[model samples]
Target: MNQNTKIYGLVLAGGHSRRMGTDKGLLHYHNKPQREFLYEQLQNICDAVFMSIRPEQQAELPRGFRHIVDENMYRGPLNGLLSAHHSFPEAAWLVVACDLPLVNEKILKYLLERRNKKAMATAFATRKTGLPEPLAAIWEPQGLRQAEIYMKTAASSCPRKFLLNVETTLVHPEDDLWVANANEPEEQQRLLAKLNII
Candidate 1:
């Protein structure tokens, strides 16, 4: 953890989950909801942790947890990320998506250890595709500012694409599966099998 930088954890849970037919964040992955699991993991490393959720999903959120409701009508993870930035512009956010069941403390620790504060953002590079995993990333204040500027443009609002064009530090994950995201029932089943639950 960089002492000079105030790092906060933002759990992206605002997704519609149309493909999963349910809220992926509410799914049980490690004897608890995935969102709760991730929130606890973030609590260990961050000064404060907040879950990014849509307004309608507020009733479904677990009690005693701090959250930021998305104010933007834009679709996708960008809405959550930007909303978080808007709420706390001074803090660098270690954003994590709820669907990443394989994400553990070890992976987050590694990310923090190797974080390049000088860069706009520090993210992991997928071993298979060699592309930046934007969701599991530490977005510095400057990076978030740039993202806000990019959002105003006519270009695509894909975070990965923004990472590709920015000054970001990307590192390879210790284990490929550590960054695996289960978005659908089949993917969740596969992850469950990998965890020896099936």
Candidate 2:
């Protein structure tokens, strides 16, 4: 955690949750909405934190937390990341998805502590494939700029793919569970069982 670098947290909660059959961010896994939980956690480590949401979801956002609504028509997490980058192009974004129920302070601390300032981005490598996990990563200003340019072409929508072709510092997560995200009911149930919620 460089004291001079302004790192802002971006909680991605704009997804339509088509696979989950409900808003995954609004789901309760830790006695509070997962979005809220992640927001609180980010608040502790970031200079400031904002929720990435759609304009329609603004009304449902909890009060007192800052947010940036999608301005472009693009779908998926790229929209949230780029929206936040456009809003605050100077600060590096510590991006996290709302569906990651197992994300914790320790994991966040580890990521920040090991952030490679010189790399285009600092991300965790998936335990399964060793590919960069863009959502659980830090996107520097330069990286975001590159991403903006990439977005102009049809080849750069998928974040993981973008990471794969970029200069990213990939670290193995201390615990793979920290990066696990639940996108379906069955996955959510499995996570719930792991958390002893069932």
Candidate 3:
């Protein structure tokens, strides 16, 4: 069924960035903050978009896009996902991390094309790796409810554990470019070189 569902685009920007010693989302690549580029790309497909930010960093958020503060106070991306799911329970949520440099339009389109309403969620998977990249996934409204229930019982907000219980659909990572991310300085440099932006 072509649901034509209005999937909400959620950019996970609540990470502490302890490893990098800087906000990963605010770092620059190609003269634009990484998060802005991601939001720009995501806007192409999402019916509406919002950035998930930590409460303390709310002032640092870019203008124009709506912001959803993580009210649950968990230290993982699941908190942001749950917040969005709760806010828009009637629609699927396209959750993406802000630091991923390679999540281009092509891969996003491919993932969206494979979405099944019957499944709890859908995500990309490389044949070599299992369901490891939770950063790039689609969460149905029902999946969010399942996650919320699991989280309430588990008393923890781990996305992996939540995913274990849901009916998640998977897609082959035929497009390796979507896996590119800037986790550290070296990785950022590599992304710049790969994109020929530096």
Best model per lDDT: 1
Between candidates 2 and 3, the TM-score winner: 2
In model 1, which regions exceed 4 Å deviation? 1-3
lDDT of 3 by residue, 71-164 (tens): 8744578888877777777888888897787776777888888977788788777666666467888888777778777777786667866676
Candidate 1 lDDT tens digits, 1-198? 344889999899999898899999999889999999999999999999999999998997878999999987455688999899988888899999998988877789899888888888999887888888999999998898898888888368799998999999998897788888888999999998888867
Q: For model 2, name the residue pairs that clash.
A: none
lDDT (Cα) of model 2: 0.88
**Cand. 1 TM to true fold:** 0.96
RMSDs, each prediction? 1.7, 1.8, 2.2
Best-to-worst order by TM-score is: 1, 2, 3
List ranges where model 2 is wrong by over 4 Å: 1-3
| Candidate 1 weakest lDDT stretch, 10 residues | 71-80
How displaced is residue 154 in candidate 3, in Å? 2.6
Model 2, span 1-198: residue lDDT tens: 344669999999999999999999999999999999899999989999999998999888878989999986555688999999888888899999988888877788889999988788999886887989999999998898888788788554798888888899998986788798899999998988889988
